[model samples]
Structures are given as C-alpha cells and as structure tokens.
Target chain A: MDLTFTERENAFRAECRAWLERHVPKESLGSGDTREGFARHLEWERELFDAGWAAVSWPKEYGGREASLFEWLIFEEEYYRAGAPNRVTQNGIFLLAPTLFEFGTEEQKARILRPMARGDVTWGQGWSEPNAGSDLASLRSTARRVEGGWLLSGQKTWCTRGAFCDMAYGLFRTDPAQKRHHGLTYFMFPLHGEGVTVRGVDRLDGDEGFAELFLDELFVPDRDVIGEVNQGWYVAMATTSSERGLTLRSPGRFMATASRLVDLYGRYRASAEPALRDAVIDAWIDAEAYRWYTFQTVTHMVDGQDVGASSSLNKVFWSEMDVRTHETALALIGDRLELDIDHDAPESAGDAVDEGAWMRGFEFALAGPIYAGTNEIQRNIIAERVLGLPRK
Target chain B: MRFAFTEDQLLLRDTVRGLLARECPPDVVRSAWEARSGRAPSVWAKLAEAGVTAMTLSEASGGLGMDELDLALVLEEAGYAGLPDPLVETVAVGAPLLEAVGTAAQKERWLDAAAAGDALIAVGFEGQPFVPHAAVAAVALLHRGGDLYAVPREELPLEPQVSVDRSRPIARVDYAPDARHRVDAGDRAALDAAVGVAFDRAAWATSCVLLGLTRRMLDLAVQYAKDREQFGKPIGAQQAIKHHLATALIRQELARPLVYRAAWSLAHRDSVRDHGAHVSMAKVHAANAARHVAKTALQVHGAIGYTIEHDLHLFQKRAWALAAMYGDVGFHRARVGAATLPD
Candidate 1:
C-alpha cells in the first residue's frame, strides 16, 4: 500500500521533529543500558510532557492533543527520531490512558489521567502472579469485599517497574468461589499505600526495573475499580488490544535508532565479528517492515476499517525486532556490554552507553513474544480467525 | 479515506463471483485441466459478455473506467475459479497500459476490439519467454528499447513449455525486432508503470487464489479432524491437529488485509513509499501461509491426501507455483528491504 505521509502530515512531522531536537536531552536517552539508564530516560518523558508533546493520542480532556490515529503515528515517529528514552509510564500512557478513556468513569479520568499526561505519575502493571504467567486465567491474587472498600492480599510477580511506581492497576480475584476467569476484578491500588510490600528482582547486572509485590490486605476504595466487577478479563483484554493495536513506534524513530546502531557498528568494526553485521542488516529490515506495516494500519484505521488482528502482527514483529537490534549493539560492544552505562558515563567511552543494554534487549524481546500472548498464539489467531480455517 | 470497497466495487465483486460460480466451476476447471488447450474460450466469452474485460478502461474507450484495484477484484475471482483465460494479461496488463500510453488511433481500434471480446492481448518481455496464458492469444505486446510495440500474435513464435499449473497454458514467445509496431509515447516510463501494475495485480491475484486454496485446505483439515478417530476421540479434539490448523489460519489472517491493502493502494494510487513493499510482504506472507496450510492439511489427512487421485495436491501444486510467480519469497523480501530504507 501507499505508505508516504501527506504534505500536511509531513509538515506536522517536521514541526514535531524540530521540537524533539530541542527539548530532548541526549544524555538521558537510552543506549539500551542499565535500569539506571532507563530511570534517566524518564527525564525525557518529563521534558516531552512539559513541552506538550507526550501522549498526543489521549483525549484533550486529559491534556492530550486529541490527534487522529495518523497524527498520533507522526508524533511517535518524531519522538523516536529524537532518540529520546523509552517512556517510564508507557503502561499508564499507552495502555491505561486509552483504557480510562474508553471504560473509565469521568471522575476516574479526571483523577488519574491528567497527572499521567503531565508526567507527574508513573504506573506499573500487576497482572501476572507467580503461577499465572501465560495461563493468565489461573491468577491467585485475591481481593475481599470490605465495608469501606476492598482488601487485596496476594503476590504479583514480574511486576515491571512495580518497585518504582506511584500506583498500580491490576486484576484481582474478587470472588474466589468462582473458578477460572469469572471471579477476577480490575483495581487501581497505590503502590505506596499501607500493607503493600515490593521486592525488586535483581538482574545479572543488578537492575531492578522488575519487581515482585506482596499485597497484604491493602485497602482500595470502590471508586478505584476500573469497570464492572468480575468483568476485568474482558477489560484487560481490551486494554492489551489497544496496547498492541496502536502505532507503537514511528519510522523516524527506528531510522534514528538504526543510524545510531550503524554508527556504533562502524566504530567497532575491527572488533565486531561478521555475524554482527548480518544481525545489523536483519534489524534494519525488521525496523523498516514494521514501519511500513504501521503506516498501512494507520491508513486502514483512518479509513474506518476494524483494525484489530493486523495490529497484533505489527506488535509481534516490532517487539521482536527491537530485541534483535539492541542485542546486535551488545554483541558489537563485546565485554564492555556489561558495564552500567548511565548519564554519568564519560561521553567519549562507548562502554558508557553499552551497559549490556542489548542483553536486556534480548531478554525483553524473549519476553515480548511471550507477553501480549505468545507468537504461537498470534499465529493461531491469524489462522483460525483471520483465515477462517475450520476448527480442528 | 475509505478502505472498504465502494458500493459499485462491491456490486462488481458480487457480479463476478456469481458469473464464476456458473461458468468457471470446479468441473469446468477440471475439464480444461484434462484437455490440451488448458482454457475454455466460451467461458471467456461469457466473462467478456459480462464486461469483465472492459471494466478497467475508460467509458470513452467503450469500457467501465474502473481503477486498477476494481479489476483486481475480478482477477481474484477468476484466479479462484482456476479460470485459464488471459483476463489478467488482456485486461489487467494490456488494457491499462494502452490506456496510459496508447495513441488516439491505437486506443480507438484496439481498445474497442478488446472491450468487444474480439481480441486478446499478451505482453512479451525479453528475459522471460514464459508469459502466463500466452498461447491462444490474439495480440502480443513486445517490449524493446524501453518501448512497447503491438505485434500481431500470428507473427510471433511461441514455444510451449510444460507447466506445473495445467489450468493456464504458458508459452515462451520469441519476437523479431522488425516485426514490432512501435508506439510514439515514452516507452520506458510506460513500460515501468505497466510492469509495476502488472506485478502488483499478479502478486495480489495469485495471493487471493492461494487464499481460496488455503481456505479449502483448512476446511479439509478441519473436516478430517472431525471425522477421523484417534485415542477414542475425534482427531479434531487433539491439540496437535487443532493447533496446527490454528496456526495456518493465523498466517492467512495476517496476510489477507495486506493483500487487500496492496490491491487497494494500487487501485487508488495511494502512497508509493511502500509501493512494492506491501505487495511483496503480502505475496511472501500469503505464499508461505498457503504452503504451510496445504502441507499441514496433507499431514492431518494422513494417507489419502497424498494420493494423486485426491484434490489436495492440486492446491499444493498451485501454492508452489503461485509462490514462484511475481518473484519468490526471497526476491520480494529484498524488495521490502529496499522500499523500507531511509531515502
């Protein structure tokens, strides 16, 4: 399909790119390094919010630009091209903001969405319990009905950014008497609230971006409930759909990153193995394909086609592609990859930006195919639902 | 802004679907497959009478004046029927190219004859002698020195090549330089646009045909799973069969929109940054999807599916053949890489 932007869209993109070049701090951008590097990355999000450039897809009422889906893509492209850090509040802004817009009450929107748009608050996901990673229906986290509110008690593992966030929105088993998927309810609980304990997961490089949380009778008001009680699975599914469905990255963004990787690879060419070059090319193709695929989806969405399954395919491709690109960078840096590169690292030292970002990328990419449903699951959806195969 | 087909396009799709249902049924395709000519001209006449031939040309040229994507819908249905007619060559390639580059005299004479079902046209390129459905055609478009010349079919030498696909007879056509009827336009640009449109349409039509075949493969797998017994239950109940079929469906689903998107973009002349990239992706994706589904269908059917007496191999052969058409997966993937890179 035709993938180029319109002149008007192009002009808008130029404006956004100009703004990004000025407002984004180069030091705070990710070299795909340590948890501290990610933390520094948040400063860029703060800058974007201050400049009114973040979360343009959110409704205007929540301090967003209320852009069309296509414009939103233009915004992301510019943001990525700027080489800004990944959003610390992506779960809140990309996933929860849309969820709140659709299913959240007006009051809830007023309370939670503005701070998120303003970069004043960060949110973490609390979906997977220790036993319920892929078979999400098997969650054991419990929340009992109380006189004033609900009392939550259970442990949530793999809680990304859980130890460092202001609040959490999770699916809790509000009715344990009901089995497998029926009894769960969605709740918005403050991570700093009483009776909640968070233990960060220590990585090989000592990054604690991921956490495990124990919710010991944490009280949450009925007002914090996202949608109808026990209907959270559907709501969660919808949220995941929006999370995966929208334009996640812009072509400009990938172009910038690919250029950076290419530069880094050139810098290390003497030490860099030939295999690394192949990986760079692979990353380049994936990034480009994903970019075109995204533009096509935006066109389809703008044209009013129901754009669900197609977006899933894009998510699967890009998420995996992101991992591959980052991993290639790590390989080029070799032993210097493990050093904790951060804002404090010397500007001239490549290791300052290496910090095993690629290894983490590999891990994250590995998880990507697993999270948002495995690639196998996506394939099944494509086959049965999209292709209309006879159900065996 | 609209991605869904316009009302008239929908009606055209329905009309073509109905016409194919009667004239190009499975039996007709089978009969043609069994015969020497590999095509039923009467069926082509019926399609021509239905105006499938003229739907892409301008009304002033005695045709419907539809865009390239509208004609794609007609071609897709024809592919589904395994219709051996040169509808793709005549309407999809020759007619559109003539409309773009033909002189007033040429369009007046040839366009009317083509629309009136009195002539058929085929494209002759230098490197590839094998033009799909080239035999039994009335007109040949020979490309040389970047210009397209209209050569009478009688003047060309065609060597019949045994093809894997029997539904369409292909021939390697050789042309002499002096026999060409040179046109006055910018031949290079015309040839470029024509080839692009032809590849886009062929890639998409082949994909939709694969879709139809894949859909049939999935059905066959599911039906066999339902009927066959294993471990005291229907094999359909087994996760192995169920999941295999499921994955095939996923690939098909993933590719369907892409095929339509490619066809739609070409039809409306949408953005070109993606120009060949999307179609390549669609073709590669569809080809792999169809191949996987067909292979899995045979595996699920176990013994009977492998027999030549069965229809499974027909889909398998078509998938293999279509995958090779319009450039194979490797070629199209490289095209995607080139299309997607920073300008």
Candidate 2:
C-alpha cells in the first residue's frame, strides 16, 4: 500500500528526467501529419532507441532497457513532463511487439523486432475492413493459401498511418471451412508490396494521417505468419488488449493535459463562473484518478496479477476523460476553437500558443470513443465478460 | 515501492468477505434491521471477534495495534455485506478518536469496551445531521469549536429520526460540547490535529461504505439483468441494459482506486492536506458510484427492484445513508476544491 518510490526508483526517475531534459526537441514536431514531420518524428524515435529509451519496458535482446513496468510508467511520466515528441512508431512498438514477444518465432523476431525497435520501419494497424468496422470478426477479407505463402485480397479502412507506413499487421481468414473466430490467421506484410494501394482519407485532423488500403492478391510469405494459423482471433486479442488497455495512453499525456488545463484555467479563473471552475476541478480529479489508477495497474502487472475486466473499464474511463478534459479547456478558451494547427490568423498569432492543438485534441478525443473497439463494444465486454452478464 | 496490499491483508479481505457471506447474509441483515433495535449485535460481535475493531487500536489498550489500511479492507467488506451494525463507527471513528484525544479515563471506559464489542459509540461530526447508531450506542463522540468531546448517550436528549435504511438508527441529538464532557488535551493545535484524525478516519471509512454498497448493488443489477427476460430474451442481451450495467461497472472500478489511494495516503500520512483531497476524492467518487449504480440497478430491474422485498433498495438506502453521512458528493467536492485550488 506504499506510494513512495524506492531510492533506486527515485534514482531511475532522476536519470530519466535528466535524459529527457536534454533530448526533448526545442520546437513542436509539426503534428507529424506531413511527410517531413513524420520523418522527423521517426528520427526522434531513433534517438530514443539509441539511448535505450524507445521501448523501455521491452527486453534488452529486442533493443530495449528491459526496465520494469513501474520504470516504464515512470519513464512515460517524465517523457510527457518534458514535452517529448509523440512516438510515431507506437502501433508497431507497443501493440504488435507484445504479440511478437508472446507468439513470434525466433526467426521472425530476429528479422523484425530489432529493426522495428530501431525505428528503421514504421507500422500501421490493418484490422478494420470497410464492412467490418465494429464487428471485426465478421470480416470478409480473405487470404488463400499459395505456394510457400498466402495471398491477401481485401480492403482495410481506417488504417492509422496506412498512407505512408512501410509495414502492417492484421488478421486474415486462413481457412474457408471454419467461420467467425475459428479459421483466421495473423499476418504481417510490407505495405508497399506489389498488390497494395493506399489512398489517403480525409480525417478529422485534415491530414493524410489515415488511409484506406486496397489489396489485390498481396503475397505474404509463410514466415510473416505471427501465431498458429486459424488462431488469429486469439493472437489479435493480445494486441487489442494492449491497444484498449494500458500500453498506449500512459498517464503522462493526461497529467500534462491536466496541468495545462489548470494553468489555462488559472489565467481567467478570477473572472470566470464558479460552475466552470468546478468543471475544471472535476477534470483535474479525473486525470489524477487515471494517474493513480495506472500506478495500481503497474503494481498488479509487477505482482503477476491479471487486470481482467479492468482493461474494458479503463478504456471507457480514459476516453471519456479525454473528451471531458478537452471540452473543459475549450470552454475556457471560448472562441479560439476555430484555429487550425497551422493557423495564420495574424490578429491572434501572438497569443495562439497552439490553441489549434487543443482544437485538434478535441477532435481526436471524439475518435477515442469511436476507435479501439467503440465504447459501446467495450461496455458490452465489461457487462458480459467482467460482470458475467448474459450474451445475446 | 509496493502499491498492492500484503498477502495477509489480502487474506484478511477474503476472510471478512467469507464471514459476511455466511454470517451476515441479506436475510440476517434484514432481520436485524426490522428488529426493535434495528442493529445486529451478533454481527457486531462477530466483526469484533474477527479483530476488525481492535486492528487499529494499540496493544496496550488490549488491541491489535494495526493501521488504517488494515481496517479499511475490513470496512470495505462490511460495506459489501451491507451489515446493519455500528461496528464501523465504533472502531474507525470512536476508538481512534478516543485513543488519539480521549482522556486516560475516557480510554479505559470506551476504548476497551469498544475493542471487545461490549459497547457501541456513535460519532456526530460538526454540521452533520443524523447521528448513526445513536439509538443503540452507549455514548456519543462529537466535535465543536475545533475540540473533540465524548458524552454518555444517557446525558444527551435524542429525537429519533427514521432513516431510509432501517438498519441505520439515526437521531438528532440535543447537546453542544459541554465542558464537563470535553476530552481535554494540550492546546488548540493538538485538539485540531486529533479532530483532523477523527474526521479523516470517519470520512474515509464512509467512502469505503459507499464502495462496498456500490459493488453489491452492481452485482445485484447484473444478476437480475441476466435472468430477467424482455421481449423473449434476457435484458442483459440488450445493449441498453448492458450499457447501464457497464457504466455502473466503470464507476465502481474508477472509484475503487481512489478509495485505495486515499487509504494509502492517510495510512502513510502523505501530506495531511493532500491526503485530505485524496479522501475527499474517494468520498466524492464513492457517492457517485453508489448513487449511480442504485439508479441504474432500479432501471434495469424495472418494478421488481423498487419493491421492499427486493434486496436492491436495502443497499440503495444504505448507500444513500452513508453518502449523506460525513459529507455528500457536493460537500466533499468543495472540500477538494479548497484543498487543490489556489486562493
């Protein structure tokens, strides 16, 4: 029940704080929506890798520090505190890599994980198809067996960073005889392969950050099969669990946003309405709640305990918290919500301070409820799996 | 660096949960509530036998000398059982307050009796209305002018006030910290510190009370949703019913950490002021979880949940009672505001 970190933990924190103090970029990373911005972010991830900070919790053999979960949590807190650039390789590094650690063969690991950790390649998720948005298992995407490999042919929409990513990993129907979750297989392939076409989608960010991939018999070699064939559903759960749960949305982002919200609120609070003040207070407490809850979770993982239904509950909380926190900031900002990230409205240029990012954050928060297995789906999981409610 | 409880504490939780499940079932709780005294003395005795009351009291005072975190787990279990007894008030607020600030004679009189479950002591913080267990308690611990006091229940005139939760016997007492009964100490500073301990301990326990009740309520709701068929299928199959219960699950999950963190903060004495906000957050979220789950449970159950025969209202009323006690959501939110917000 202790909250105080050990001297060793404190020393680790000090080392991390010192490294971030020096390495964080001096300027914004330009939203990483542009190709140049993405490359810069990739270079920043490389810097992190060189310093053994890219995936602090990953095993050292895979090019990580092999830090404890608590250390990883601490690193994340310091990373956000120091205003470090966003990780352009998060999807590959956090989601896919854990599955790799769990199920990938030695040969696949030797070939993929090191380069993935080094940021030499970036990856995007290709799980959702045009007809399989929420009910992903009902996907019509097919992969027929070929000589020494499989051929992938289908459409994958809402592919985050799909417009430019070099690689993707997703589920494919491996056997036509079995249905639903039975006959699927996990596969990873080059996004720029012979039969793949990526078209940029108009996303809320007004950038080509998201794209739709059209696959015309894309050949994926047998070596790229992640887990056992006809068991992609099982393998994909590991990645989705990581996605919706803890790996991606570290407390650092929430803590940073919360502090910014408080600092922003303080500027106009003296003249603001009291309800608005209470709303800000509520927002702050929710962030603090998330922060402390993560500590407990890291403790559970460290103690070798299963988080169980908490992943679903955490998904509902942080997504909603993101929305509420952003809304409160927008309410305080009043009318600056119209400014885009590259806003050049001269009259407000001196004070913008990237009010546009907050606007962008508000839009992104809306996506939180929609993506990562929509909150409704998450709630069903909680109700059914966690609460033991009856399934339809 | 460990954030989770020790194996012993985990065992203590499981034991209390098991004891309450067998000895303090819903029927026993109802019987105790419906009885003339509206409290289960046997349940209180069972808890005292289980060492819940004596855990935080000093061994010199014939107690276990455990800490707040230890007792918090037991209190959470009690809340889960919706136990209709004054044990939580007796131990968390009464004994701790007595040991911290009561005169030597006061400790000899109440603390030992409380540890043995031979007596009950109700606490009434300043500005609070209903004094719980005042009807059955032998004494009352109150605060006024920043000083703590203990007066025999026989000395104060009490006007009986019926509570929605029948097991909680409440009343408005007619007494203002009489000097003769004042538990005197060094000076105003020591008095304030002791009062803070009593206040924080009681408020934090009330938060646990809400948490336990919320879990019970959510469980009941989920069970009913699974069995109650609507339009030829279980209601839980419907997205609306599942969503309602899921939201309740979310509230319970979010609030559980706040409660534990508050327990940890107060147990470690990590910044009295920050801990104040910590407990306040727990209190606020507990009330939110309890009230929200109660409402959602009723909605999911339709007419059946609204009946007195049903178990939902019992937990609902108890949750609301605990929430209204110490401080409601708005009260603690303001306390949190004072603690965290700048002047």
TM-score of every candidate relative to the true structure? 0.85, 0.96
**What fraction of the correct interface contacts does each predicted structure contain?**
0.12, 0.74
lDDT of 2 by residue, B1-343 (tens): 6667888998999999998998888998888677836677677778778888787788988999887788777888888898888756788878877887888888888888888888888988888887878878878888766767788878877998888787878899867668878896678898887777678878899888888999899889888888888799998999899899899988887888888889988887745448888888888888888899889989998999989999888899988888877877787888887866666
Error of 1 at B171 (Å): 2.1
Alpha-carbon deviation at B200 in model 2, angstroms: 0.9
Once superposed on the true structure, which residue ranges of model 2 sit more than 4 Å away at CA? A343-349, B270-273
Tens digits of per-residue lDDT for model 2 on A1-392? 77888887899899999999998988777766556678878889889999999998887888888788888888988998898988889899989999999999999888888789888988999999988988999988889999999999889888888787899999989898998988999999888959999987868777678889899999999999998999999999999999988897988888888878787787768666878888888887888788788888888988888987678889889999999999988888777667666623323444555577788889888999988899999998988898888788
lDDT of 2 at A218: 98
lDDT of 1 at A181: 82
Best by lDDT: 2
Tens-place lDDT per residue, model 1, A1-392, is 33446787787788888887877776545432345555565666667776667777666666777677777777776776776667777888877877787789999999998788665787888888889876789999888999978999999987667767778888999888888889889899988868899888865434576788899999999999999999888788777777666533455666666767777766787886656765665566555555555665666677777876655565565566676787788788887776654434536355544444455455555666666666666655554454444445
What TM-score does candidate 2 get on C-alpha atoms? Answer: 0.96
Question: What is the iRMSD of the candidate numbered 1?
Answer: 5.2
